[model samples]
Target chain A: MTSQHPTPGDARPGGRTARNTAAVLQATLDELGERGYGAITVDSVAARSGVHKATVYRRWGGVDGLVRAALEHSTERHWEPELTGSLYTDLLRLVETVTSGFTEAPEREVSAAAVAAAFESEEVAEALHRFMSDRHRRAAVIVTEAIARGEAPRGTDAEEVIRSAIAPVYYRLLISREPVTADDLRRAASITAAAAAAGTFTGTPGPPTP
Target chain B: MTSQHPTPGDARPGGRTARNTAAVLQATLDELGERGYGAITVDSVAARSGVHKATVYRRWGGVDGLVRAALEHSTERHWEPELTGSLYTDLLRLVETVTSGFTEAPEREVSAAAVAAAFESEEVAEALHRFMSDRHRRAAVIVTEAIARGEAPRGTDAEEVIRSAIAPVYYRLLISREPVTADDLRRAASITAAAAAAGTFTGTPGPPTP
Candidate 1:
């Protein structure tokens, strides 16, 4: 077993090292989707990726590292929310995409596995946090555009708006294990858009309840 | 293996069967908390509960049935959202309770495990669905009371409001893997309450965008 880990210098663009990293991460994701986190091992990932075991361990350290790295690798892929010209439509599209990701095949297994893996590994959990935070930041643009269009106030927390619009969808899909109905999606988008317009998400404390 | 399965006729309140059922399900939850879903087995639960392995299998069928039964058992325990005379405070308390269930010990492990297990078993998924649906129905009393008090419109979707108030917390706790802050709880409650009063949650269609 090599004690030395791969350095940043090994990450040169489009090199053999990059190719190997891509293959290993993709294989790691596939293995996770197929067998889940508990059954995946270094040898399995290495065999699936066609990368040598020693190299896999030398680079990723172990299964936790491999899963975490795979999540981080996914963040590098180009993704942006569809801008549907209005805040409500933009949020509706965003939530629709979120629902599809879990309901659709192939990606469904990988998505659920990633969330499940987080419970078992702090490393994977933190990577998921970073990945989700990145998505949140990217999705905040729709709220920002809405603000410019006079749909919401200047002080609105854009990320919180995104959270409001999509969180219910996540709740139904994963935690509640309920089917995300069309009305569910519409209610989430509409409530969030209206709340934004009402200045509820501006972060100001509400007046004390009488 | 026993060819026959447990029947409801075997259940007698305050009888040996009742005690055994309680012990087995509690042990199942304990095992799930400590070892997670993947590591739990009928034998382990039986050993922990001090019930015989054959009895456990005969009763629960296997690990999946044990988990599903445990979740169903949890629903039987009396649970109601706090009524704080207003929808906002009630939701704040509700979300606080949710955040605590995931961040605190003992229950936290089991809560996280149950959600993770749903990804692995359709039986557990359906059970979780029933459990959360039961929770939603019970918690809707707060909104029902609010409607009576004229805080929200008569037509507001009570369960949907509860979902909106708590979904972001779940998203942060389980999906995004972020720490739930006081601000997050307050914001969720505030947004949902304001939207409830605004009739955004009444299931009415919004005006067509220009």
Candidate 2:
């Protein structure tokens, strides 16, 4: 959603500018995770990043811009679903990855903080939309691979299947505020996998897999 | 999770006291919806409610107390899922209701705000947990009705079934930031209903629904 490189005419790429940008964005995320979006400020980010306050304001604009950039920067980080041999196990892996992102720390605070920040700011919301959409598309590769393996019928809505397998986990952790058991994860994976095999996702059912 | 009546030794429950409580809580919700959690304050709620600031502080304590109370207040609202005979239609109704709570006016702001507030405050989070749990249990009746009618096998986890049916809708709306179409709703209902009939939710298959 945002370029990793500096905005045109803003600053040159690499060296001191690159180091400063990385430090400032990381500090912004740390602030978000620790104190949440409401407490983040340019001065605090600068102090934490060791980048001058004037440099932060000049480059990132303000807290909103900083958060948006941080989200986009994080999106560019290496992430891929572990493609287990079968669709069910592959989806289980996918959902488990999602659970860890929320349940485990470092990522947990920022993941939740981003979602919470979205409600308060349009800039944050748009950035989150892009971030999540990127994840969905990347994870859809599992379903796509399943189709090639003849586990699911052709023309399946791969992203929809991905959403189905992971949504329950999110609903439990974030909305319902319930603990997601192993059984819960298994059920989600099994349901989505079975539905896909039955051609429920393709919208035109072929013969069900025997 | 909180009592609807006055706290012990706080005040009487009838007439002016009740009126004041309702006004202050409603004002709190209004402030939450309009300005969000960060912007809400006792003074603003007092001004909005036309109750005195000292009274607001004395009763609600602070913004956290006000938000927690408002969430608890909203949970007491009368809500029941539309039972449309079949599990699929029933779930469709449930998800549609969930979508509208985020999309429509009056309730939309409060609904999103409450979920957002839960991330920031433990008090609000617990209140949201209770609120959503109540909704989950109430909506599970559709699955219970299905079991009784032999549409699904006995011993199905009715609440888990409800979670599967509605989770995707929420994922699309809040997490992925996608626009939910009628097709998305239908697909969710169908997948969940089929899974239930297949004995996926029961953890032990007796026989598939004929």
TM-score of chain B of each: 0.92, 0.89
Q: Please list the residue runs of candidate 2 whose C-alpha ends up more than 4 Å from where it truly belongs after superposition.
A: A1-14, A204-210, B1-14, B204-210
| Global lDDT scores for all candidate models | 0.89, 0.87
Q: Clash pairs of candidate 1? A: none
Q: Candidate 1's residue-wise lDDT over A11-71, tens digit each?
A: 6666568879999999999999989998899999999999999999999999999999999
Q: List fnat per candidate, in order.
A: 0.57, 0.55
- Please estimate how well model 2 matches the true structure, expressed as its whole-model Cα lDDT: 0.87
Q: Evaluate candidate 1 and give its CAPRI docking class based on DockQ.
A: acceptable
Against the true chain A, what TM-score does chain A of candidate 2 give? Answer: 0.90
lDDT of 2 at B109: 85
